[model samples]
Target: MRHEELFYLLALQKVEGVGDIVAKKLISHCGTAENVFQTKAAQLKMIDGIGSMVLRNLKDKLVFEKAEAELRFIEKNNINWTYFGDEKYPERLKHCIDGPVLLFASGNINLNKKRIISIVGTRQITSHGTEFCKNLIAELAPLDPIIVSGFAYGVDIVAHQAALEHNLQTIGIVAHGLNQIYPKIHKRYVSKIEENGGFMTEFWSSSNPEKENFVKRNRIVAGISEATIVIESADKGGSLITANMANDYNRDVFAVPGRITDKFSQGCNNLIKTQKANLLTSAADVVYILNWNFETKAKPIQKQLFISLNNNEQKIYDYLQKTGKQLLDIIALECDFPIYKISSTLLDMELKGVIRPLPGKLFEAI
Candidate 1:
């Protein structure tokens, strides 16, 4: 976007009572942020939700000064930004009514045609949660999905580290501005993370890591990804907030099931019990639920002949070959395997290039 337009948009954000939804409405009606200011009061009053307070606030000239200062900060620091209408903005987030009109980013972040998943959990991560989180990323490494997290301690940092270990792009959706790191100790990971993925936020350079900012930040972590996973959380926490946001966005939510007596597992258990999230056991659950196709790059058709399949995989491959395409449940029943076993087996087959997954949980021999 042009500097002139961005300046207007930033000023529009400073207008009290005008938020992402209202700004979007104004922009959509006026065609551009600059045009919004140029539009007549009578014309603006015709907009559905435009009220007296919002109209009055738009006249505040101080917003311009603030916008100018922030713009200078952006230029001086070489900060990267994306407007809501820009093609480079997160495609999934664009559909969200509350998504930020402008997103500031740093590092080599790219979301084009990428499989993005957000992993969020309690700051007090348990040993089991850490192992589960790390193993999950490692198992999903071959699919090369981008990992999204809050960049906080516990599960957030664990997910980022796991993604980095596998050399996959990992994005840190921060609660504060990009001008400073929140925990201070995490400054060490900044360079390494920027090398692969990077940090993203809607806050300005002048903003601080306030308490309320995290709830707002949760929306981005939820909205930007196709799915959100909770490795561990208490009955109430920020991770649950993120899960609810993901559910509200109509995206898939998954939680690792744990013992009933464990405090950290209560939230995940409750989510599963209430059917708010799918019961996540292994990477195969994600692969099956998201219907991810592992065979993106081209490989010779004859390559499957050279690959070896175990007894269960061979059975499914033979069945799929004979039956053409079949539902996951049907395959499980026909192959005399449980649903959990069938899901893992199908994912394994997909990774081995012997079978391909289709839409709606259907699979066929390659």
Candidate 2:
């Protein structure tokens, strides 16, 4: 982004009563933060949700001071950031109405064509929760997914460490600015995390680890991933809040079922009983529900003149061959075919002996 544009975006964020949702609405209507500032008061007043009070606050000069300071910090620290419109911004987060307008990041993080999931739980993680979290990462490592979690004590730290041990990229969604690590003792792991992955936050350099910031931070953790997994939580905790936010975003929610009597297990058990979350037993449950399969190598074969197929059918055939047997629904999604179309095509291919139908609506290329 250009410096002039970023300066206005930072200033827009500082405007009172302007939260992420409101800021996004304004930016969408005005084209850019700089344009929002350049537009006349009459034009701005015509926009929905732009009240007299908001208009009045937009004139405050102190916001520019704050923005200038933040811009200097960004330049001095070599901090990397992505605006809401930039391609580098989290794709899933763009669907969320309340996602941050500007996401500040650190480290060698990469999300290109990668699967992402957020793992969250209580700060006072038990032995059972720790073991489950680590084992889950180890099992999922082969898929090469980007593991995301809060860089906190207990379950969060354990998940990040497990991903690191497996050579998988891991991300820590921190509440505070990158200027300092919260729970300072975790400083030892900072260098290592930056090496493989890194930290992300919406907070600026002057922002401290305030009480409400953690609650606010949960939204990014929930919005950026395809699913949110709660390893363990008390009846009331931040992890549960993150799970709730994920559900609100319409993302998949998974909770590791545990003994009902345990304090930390109460939240997961309640989530399962209420049907708010899937009963997660192992990584296979995630793989099955998310419809992820092990990538298979294509078996080279010469073309057969007797077989006839359309472009869509050939694509489906190749996908089934590369991924082994898959459910009918998953086949349509992966092969980019419509459900109605895929069913008939698969039946035709099955009759042709190019593919075989298995039990439970699965199909495999023969």
Best model number under lDDT: 1
Model 1, residue 317: what's the lDDT?
Answer: 83
How far in Å is the alpha carbon of 52 misplaced in model 2?
0.8
RMSD of each: 3.2, 9.0
- Report the lDDT tens digits of candidate 1 across residue range 1-366: 589988998999899999999999999999999888889889999999999889999899999999999999888999999989999999999999999999999999989756999999999999999999999998788788999999998999999999999998999999888899978999999999999999999999888989899999999999999999999999999999999999999999999999999999999999999999999998888987897879534353474473477788888888988999999999999999988677778887776677887888888887
Per-residue lDDT, model 1, residue 116, is 98
Question: lDDT scores for all predictions?
Answer: 0.92, 0.87
Residue 28 shift from truth in candidate 1, angstroms: 1.0
Candidate 2 off by > 4 Å: 296-366
**What TM-score would you give candidate 2 relative to the actual structure?**
0.82
Indicate the worst ten consecutive residues by lDDT in candidate 1.
Answer: 295-304
TM-score of each: 0.89, 0.82
Local distance difference test, candidate 2: 0.87
Per model, how many backbone clashes are there?
0, 0
